[model samples]
Target: MVLERFDAIVFDWDGTLLDSTAAIAGAIRGAAADLGLPDPGPERAAQV
Candidate 1:
């Protein structure tokens, strides 16, 4: 086997790359709810 190298690499901060925002937000809300805290809601959870 051989290894190859790339000259440039790019990263995307938006959800387009990983698209795990909703999962992350849901986890946050679930954790908060488990702790008896009010749900931050979708919009607020995204911000967090």
Candidate 2:
């Protein structure tokens, strides 16, 4: 009962244990800034 590609399963779909939206949004903003592009802002970043 083990998969070679994965070590564990995640069960945080409801954001009770973890919330990756902010982190992902920050990364997107950082990437855009790195490329000399305007920031999409927190609202746009989190939504789109």
Error of 2 at 1 (Å): 19
Q: Considering only N, C-alpha and C atoms within 3 Å, which residue pairs clash in candidate 1?
A: none
Q: Which runs of model 2 end up more than 4 angstroms from their true locations? A: 1-16
Per-residue lDDT over 1-48 for candidate 1, one digit per residue giving the tens place of the 0 to 100 score: 999999999898567677888898999999999999999999999887
Cand. 1 Cα-lDDT:
0.89
What TM-score would candidate 1 get against the native? 0.63
lDDT of 2 by residue, 1-48 (tens): 974887788786746877888998999999999999999998899985
lDDT of 1 at 2: 95
The superposed Cα distance between candidate 1 and the true structure at residue 44, in angstroms, equals 0.3
Computed on alpha carbons, the lDDT of every model, listed in order, comes to 0.89, 0.87
Separately for all candidates shown, the number of backbone clashes (residues 3 or more apart, or on different chains) is: 0, 0
Candidate 1 ranges beyond 4 A from true positions = 1-16
